[model samples]
Target: MVELRRSLSLVSTFLILFCTSTTAQPPAPRRSRTRAYIEVSCQITEYPDLCIRSLTAYIHGANATILSPRKLVHYALLASQHRAQHTRAFLLQVSKPLKAKKDQEYQAVKDCLEQIDMSVDQLSMSIKELRQLGREEATPSPSRDDVVWHISNMETWVGSALTDATTCLDEFPGGVRMSRMKATVKAKVLNVAQVTGNALSLFHHFVVRYRVPGSPKKP
Candidate 1:
């Protein structure tokens, strides 16, 4: 009778400890506040899903816990830059095997390689200009005009990247034999263009909502 009572007590003690340990652990982390904010901000873009996905991946890779508007814009541009670079590499690799074919499709791939390379450069420049915006703003005698010019330059570069992607597709002759290669090129280029377009939209939103350090105030 005593052993049975002791066994019951041990079981009760184990249950109590288990419950206490579980309850003492911190609650599961809630959805990231920054992710929620990004979702809302991305709604302004035509490709909201792409925007969110790209930014979320950036956030994860960067482990960016705190972010400002400029930082957010930088991240978006960086993501766009990465996408363009990957597409460029893909084109380069695929073109290697077709170099000897000397066909129309080979010619198309050659042209696309040039345009995508250009697009990669434009995006690289955009990121450079974005960083320049911050440096210009941080100067002791910051110039509103300079900041405006840099912002304008970023917009133009991003737009040009989009344009370059389209030009790449236009180079591929219609109804070609290399439909598989052409389709892959089309998809990759379009993905870069769409992501850049979303970044462009974010640039506008950043301009409207968060004034740069050197931006002029309304009279």
Candidate 2:
């Protein structure tokens, strides 16, 4: 009887341990509560599909929790910055083959390159300002003036970046308008400009929805 009771006790202990282990849960991700974060956030953007595509990769995996309204704006800024960098890199490649041509088209391409270089710099500043906004969001009680200042700077810089990209395409010489290289460069620049404009829209959305008085704070 003693041996049987001991055996029963050990089995009960094992069952308890098994149940405890099986029922245990890891912490739920912010994504779980925000299943529609991507959908709702992208819906208001200028390019919904591009916004969705740009942010979907970051919304999964270890970075999944980065989905507050402010973080979404940051993500959009990052996407714009990446697109600017890509467009700049492609322009560099296109410039290489034309460097020694010394034709009107070559000079025009050089002019576009300079404009895109400035666009990249402008986007870089926008990205920096957005990052500063993130830091401000973390403060115990961020100042309204600081938020306005950072966001205002981001708006101006990102708008300038978009204008610069447009100017790059406009500056493409009429001689090269039919060239495949020019078409490719122009398309890429347009992509960067579109995404930057969308990101700026999102920044405005965030400010209106979260930064204003009586706006809802993150849960």
Candidate 3:
């Protein structure tokens, strides 16, 4: 009887140890939420004409500010292709009430379009000035520092254009137009930030890779 009781006690101890070990083990860490990429391709087809126009205007403005005038012009020329594709899709999917709301939204888009147009003009002037400066032997060539300053200014202008576009769309409520515009703005912002960050990362990597082993300079 004593041996049997001792055996039962041993079994209980083993069971308790097994249960405690199983319960005490920490759960696998929750997976991180993956960031979603904005698909500007097929989705843009579902928006209204006014929304497309607004998006085109903003894209033009961003390109003008972010790229050379030549590139901006190239992008502007491609705008018609996008217009053709999206127009058909929008007309098919867009409702009459949505169209009516789009007419109202047009005012906001028009204002943004005008501002973007003005920005494009300014960008054109800047490009001309930059070209002329480049041509002048007496003006002295722009230093690397000057190049960086110009790039920074361009980024600031692009950011401002994005802000203006967002403000224009903020007046509207739920709809394909508003949703598309919001998504476009967000995608552009994310893209710009990602590009800038990647460029900086590459620069750091290059600096580190080429650095002298004992150099005091930190990338």
Better of 1 and 2 by TM-score: 1
| Model 1: residue 131 alpha-carbon error in angstroms | 1.2
* Tens-digit lDDT string for candidate 2 (47-77): 8888877877675643654557777777777
Tens-digit lDDT track for model 3 on 119-204? 34433443443333333323445344444444344445434433443443354444555556435433433332332222222223
Q: What are the root-mean-square deviations of the candidates from the true structure over C-alphas? A: 3.8, 7.9, 14.9
For model 2 the local lDDT of residue 131 reads: 79
CA lDDT, every prediction?
A: 0.82, 0.76, 0.38
By TM-score, the best candidate is: 1
**Prediction 1 global C-alpha lDDT:** 0.82
Per-model TM-score on C-alpha atoms: 0.80, 0.73, 0.29
Pick by lDDT: 1 or 3, better one: 1
Q: TM-score order of candidates, best first?
A: 1, 2, 3
Task: Select the stronger candidate by TM-score from 2 and 3.
Answer: 2
For candidate 2, the C-alpha RMSD (Å) to the true structure equals 7.9
Candidate ordering by lDDT (highest first): 1, 2, 3
- Residue-level lDDT of model 1, residues 1-219, one tens digit each, is 999999999999999999999999999888798898788888999999998899988668878853566767788888888888998899888888788665556778888889888888998999899888878877877677887888789888888888988898787655765577788888888888888888888888777733645445321
